[model samples]
Target chain A: MASADNVGILGWGAYIPIYRISSDEIARVWGFDDKIPDSIWVEEKAVGAIDEDTVTMSWEASRYALMRSGIDPSEIGAVFVGTESKPYSVKPTATIVAEALGIPPKKLASDLEFACRAASEAIRISIGLVKSQIAKATLVIGADTAQGAPGDLLEFSASSGAAAYIIGNPNQAAAVIVASNSYITDTPDFWRRDGAPYPEHGEIFTGEPAYFHHIVNAVNGLFEEYGFTPKDFDYAVFHQPNGKFPLQVGAKLGFDREKILPGIVTPYVGNTYNGSALLGLAKVLDIAKEDEWILVAPFGSGAGADAYAIRVTDKIEEKRSLAPTVEELIKRKILISYGEYTKMRGKIRKYER
Target chain B: MFKDSVPKYWRLRDVVYRLKYIYCRDCGKSSFPPRSKCPYCGSSNIDHRYSKGNGVVEEYTVMYQSEARYQDYQPIVFGVIRLDEGFRIVAPIVDVDPNSVEEGMRVEATLRRVRVDGSTGLIQYGIKFRPSRR
Candidate 1:
């Protein structure tokens, strides 16, 4: 595997849909007790507008990334969209993104699926592409309008969002990846069968055997491989399935609340499926200072995790402001009722027939 | 609600993504949904000029019972937009109340999904205009 430190991220951007649905509203419909919020550690989740989907959100994010990088789209050698909830099962979402950005036909493009951590896989591939001289620059995006069965527990955190990163050489590097590690297995703790509208989970099985194990094992492996301790990092971001999972996993891995909480947005935006960890990383990049080391661990159900050690550079302070910040998007909220959420989600359209 | 072949849509993408219009230098007329032949002068002498996607509403209408993909956005609104650059084109008007729509409203073109074919068919994305806040 190519070391993350060898490749640098030139730009980064985040997108959280403006619409939000409160957990209390979901509780009202499902008749769950008031403890739901505390239990799930989510107050609300971002919801995409009727016109929005993974592709559109990804476009919004990648455009910002391009703005921050200030690079010509034609110069981008590869484009990758990592999402399980892609608009078409057979078609390539990357092509639409490339075409929208006016990328030249000689570039490479493809969609990646690994439940939630698919975008991390794209990042890994991009590192190799840039490092091996295969590509001058690459675009990797994680976006999803995650679906949960109408009233399932998954609904609590299944949300819409996207994050994009442009990886290039140190000439424009806003941040450097110092180390990287990945752990994966065929553990089916959560999944949606082919053509199914929503995903099904093992419920209790998702927690112990799936998310925690993969994230922990990957982070530990990265630490062991690099001979670094938790205190070596100034901040930490874990795959935020909900607000709670990242916090709980961080605590178990010997990280402080202050270290983990800075990157935790799932409390307000829910889990954006593929975008979860990447968004967390983008938010951290927005505020992190030069020489600061941050740890990132992203887990995907059925199940795997990629652990990264990143070092913020002087370029981050300048490039971060060139594009929209995660905080700015979070502040520009338009709360919606559950009925409105269902309408925007297009649930009513298919149900009426 | 419009659907077409993948090749046609692929070709249209370059036009809609940037609002690229072919300028008929012969008559100095510009049109969108770019034409190979000039609509005014019958001249093939043309240049591709990109629109800023900013324009004003010249005419308007509301549509209900739209296509399957657009059913959720019932009462779809559309209008004729007169571009600042001396051309008129018809497109969807969005981000406004149906009752509030009227003539002479300022609008800006944005990319949006137009329609989808069968349950698992091609998705057509195109330019739609929203009332310009500016």
Candidate 2:
């Protein structure tokens, strides 16, 4: 979906919650097998405070995006939030985020729900919005306070974080979107029924049939669409469910570990669900060089994928100081106990009045 | 004592979302919790303004006692922030130890869930100050 116009990411920002709980600690609390954490390939996961949720995280991230873009928030015409854990099931997360960012009251806003790919879809729509001259710019966000049932295997990787991008013309862009493609299906590898507190996955079924299938199809489609091969990309970022998924998928796509390592954050931050792949892209955008081609593929369960080919621009270096980099937020963390994590995440239930 | 109807929450969204204040063009004085008319000069020459959310603690107090709805987060600390814009505001301080906060300490506003409405079980989100981490 590379638009005819230069509809690329003008600015990018990310927010990782300050609190974290190590996999070892979660394992210890649950009395799980010591070997299980190793299989997840994650050391720790970000945990939002009880006061924080998808709306707050998305707003913070959007603030940084506005700072980096150096655009009046009111000038932007669209605000889209992609998340699986929106605070209110019916209320749109986009309006709260737009208001917090000082975006104009009259604009398009919506909460997209397609698992993790919702934000990526928002990005594609932003490209269309900017290309059609319908908007001066558009804000697309991916964020989540992802949860797994207590003592469940998914707990090791479910995490909280957010990433946002302001997409506009190349004059203000950090990178130009060279091309994009998506693959979708009725795969229900992961889902949370209405009123369910945490999501459930089909274990191995989440791997082969859902994540891998969508990602490979979308990326292969991108390659075919643009007549480009893996060697043309300087770096590759695949959706990271666990630390291993990105690397495994990257290898399958003919990318080396070195090319994929820089974009992978789940090893330390765990999976941020909707924020997972976009945050990785933010990390790449933070360090990518002029004309370097970076391939990003986001796979969301239930399930679909969006693959993007982006070429970095020199402007990225100039806007780096406008907001805190993703690395800075990732490093600004304090380790919390499993008990403290529960308290901060509000997992503790109250029984007394 | 934190029960809010939906309209009240929506009405005060500007105060919490981005610290949007109002400037009295007639007197050049700024007032928060935006007003329809200028407070200082009693004039209608008012303009919308924003606070950078950076300030210093003018005074602070720690409360160990709490209401039933806030028992989980007891010992709440509140401060009067002397903002860079030359106005002062009272707000709860977070992400810092309750006892460590002192007057003249640097603080920044961050969006957070302030209190939950007990009657409606709806959460109220607002700006809360915290020690400037940077």
Highest lDDT: give the candidate number: 2
Candidate 1 residues A111-156, lDDT tens each?
9999999999998899889989899999999999999878887888
Off by over 4 Å in 1: A1-4, A349-353, B1-4, B23-31, B36-46, B49-69, B77-90, B93-110, B129-134
- Error at B36, model 1, angstroms: 4.2
How well does each candidate superpose onto the true structure, as a TM-score?
Answer: 0.89, 0.95
TM-score of chain A of each: 0.97, 0.97
Q: Which candidate has the highest DockQ of all? A: 2
Model 2's TM-score against the true structure: 0.95
What's the distance in Å from true for residue A288, model 1? 2.0
| Tens-digit lDDT string for candidate 1 (B1-134) | 33458787777788867678888988998987688888888899998887867899898989987756567777888898999887888888865678988899899765667766656568877678877633
The residue pairs that clash in candidate 2, if any, are A1-A180
